[model samples]
Target: MTSYRWTMHRVYDATGNDTLGPAAISMWWLARAAAEETLQGSPLASAWLKLFRSHLSVDDPYWFRWAEDLAQSAELRRAYSGLYGRFVARALLSAHLGINRFVSLKRNGVVIPGSVAVTRISKGDIPDWIAWDDRASRHVLCEAKGSLTSRDFLAPGVPKCVKEGKAQFDRVETTGASGKLYPARWVAATRWVTDHRGGTPATLLWDPPQDHRPFSEDEAARHREAMTRAWLDSIAPGLGWRDADELLAPDRSRMAIVVNAEPGPVPPSQDWPELPDNDLPLIARLTEVARLDRFVAQRRPVPSDGPQDVADLAGAQSGSQTYQASWLPRPRGPEAKPHQGDYIAALATPFGLRPMRTRADFDLLRRAQDRARDLEEPAMIIGLPVGMDPGAAPAQTTWLDGAGISRKQDLAVFDLRRVKVDLLDSGPTG
Candidate 1:
């Protein structure tokens, strides 16, 4: 396995007082973003994935030579750096701030027709992406910039990018369903010092304080619905779906399968064990039983119909629409069972069986499902492998001020690593 690391520096206000924080990036998420966000259904998706993997610090020597060859060309280096920068920025924002749903302003009308309201403002100098913060009930505007220059040269250019990003943020405005303008948070994320051999990869986040604005419940609902649809649009083509409409078809149900595996060779289909019987029913009805608030919190696509039985799959008549399928990879080694693989599947209607490793995995899915059904809130299930002590929470960093008194903030620094991937290789089948 090849491990990659980076530091996240959060700048406070325009003065740029940097505080280090803990952030993580998943290789699976990056691959998905490369296909859906960067290429956006272009024919170059596979080629881009191959190039991206080569840029990483892989175990293979050939990939290192390939990266060196690409870096020799200034134009290719810049293009690779810029595209990868946006990918890292998106992953960081999602992991640190829970800003998962992103809409590209450049494809505003095509992706989500008439969703954003930018009438009075000119289209020039707009931010790259507009995302909704479900936790804070507000909108966020971000401009992403990347550079492959040395640290000394990159430092001087960051402030210039920040100034330009802030200008772009000022030009866009969006109102919610209540006809009230949602509070906006502006961020300029720049990926500087990208060469790992010379220095660690880092992202300088410039977030400036803005005027306080009120947000209404109606507006939150509107944004969540629109953004959920937008998220589907972004992921559908990459998953081999015809379009977002097919996943969101009112007559059919949808399922999102999250598979957790150790970092190594891809496991075979027969290695997938059967799911526990007790947990099967809840997994089938996750979306149908989902509370409005919980659904809004997750912002995933929903199905219009009610729950059905998994047994019906056996005798179902031909030409009947049943369920849709897609999967996500969460490659991590469980402490207890290091070699085993697990699955967490979410469905809008009843679906057939699949394999999961342990009872704890089922319990985690149950809690998440119950939260959607009863608590009306989203669950955080992206911690380390289950059935093992997670240890103490990450320690908060502290520093002394000029007055000699110490001040502390919630910040945890950590590393992110993953195994290499071959995009052309076939994944496990049913």
Candidate 2:
């Protein structure tokens, strides 16, 4: 039992808020490894480590403010909030600051920076991050993506970072039982999820140019079935559980990843902190045990409880975009100008409808009616409801103005008579 504790904590207290616990600290290191390996020990990762330590070291506002602003930006929503959120944020800053020619600008500002500028500090509703190339009049937007497991990676398509991050490791499988080939993966590199418990082995991925966008789920799926089959073929090969167990024994030379020591793909570096000596042996043992169990699951016909979809847990459990989209209203079509558009519609939940409670509602309907009057082919607002009789009028009138942005008056009386309305999604277009 080598007591392998993180050695860098000696330089700075990275014990975390005491809430992260050993499990969290272990995952944090894995996240660091994921980034560093993908970047080949880039100074960016080194900087991220310093910033990350600040997050754990203290609650002081000075050290955390910038990080907090980046995390809260709407544009970095996916990259900043997920398990790999913090890591990606640091990477983005690294990328942005690396640019020598840049401007600090806000969202939708008409002025494009000098043609020589390499980066733009854009704020507001646009993409949270933009790397503009004024000379080319084109730019790449870097959106950081994070996932807890193979499923999340599968769910939203593999992000370029996640792919690169996961690809840094090798999970080799035996081509044949007697052959020295066996599948091994740096499983730790991909499962940096902070929000949920279970994680899947990241599907091995690659980006030769390192300038690719996030890959879709379909793209990843294209390789999954075939790869999964091949992996099973290499390790299981119809061998009984007992025989397969023997094949995966600890002394086997094929498995390169050991828990306590630097596993295959994870290079030992002075730049990075070390895992505790005691933790290494234990990590190694567990990794081996998991390796054996997973190997058997594939060799044997029984399922491996089929990893629960992280998304499923997300819906029943709540964490950022990790929840289910249940019972949501259908999106209303974009508002069209009253002059060119023909139909206006409103959704009237029996109780959600109420008479214009204030002045704003009344003005909205009046303006809409005025706009409708000017149109060549007059459009009527239709009120739709559930279980309503044909030709039945709505109790209250609710419709956006002709501009389609404002909610107008209580035309309850007109809704019952002149307005051709029904409690259905069918608007004029419908």
Q: Candidate 1 residues 1-430, lDDT tens each?
A: 1222323333333223222221234443444344345324333333543465455543321111123424678876776666666766675565444554676666332234434453226556677777766656556676677765534212322356677777776666665444536334445354444234443334555666555454477645665666656655664444334555754454221122223323233232111222346644542343233221211111223345732211111111121011110111222332332122111221111111212223443444454446444743322121111111111211122121110111111111111112111111124322
> In lDDT terms, how accurate is model 1?
0.39
lDDT tens readout by residue for model 2, 170-262: 221112212222111111112232212322222111112212222245432332322222222222321211232343344322211101111
Clash pairs, candidate 1, are 22-412, 273-355
Return model 1's CA RMSD, one decimal.
Answer: 21.5
Question: Candidate 1: deviation at residue 24, Å?
Answer: 5.1
For model 2, what is the error of residue 244's alpha carbon versus the real structure, in angstroms, after optimal superposition?
66
Top candidate by TM-score: 1
State every prediction's TM-score relative to the real structure: 0.53, 0.22
lDDT value for model 2: 0.24
Weakest 10 consecutive residues of candidate 2 by summed lDDT: 8-17
The candidate 1 region of ten consecutive residues with least summed lDDT is 400-409
C-alpha lDDT (0 to 100) for residue 268 of candidate 2? 28
- The deviation in Å at residue 400 for candidate 1 is 36
Error (Å) of candidate 1 at residue 211 is 2.8
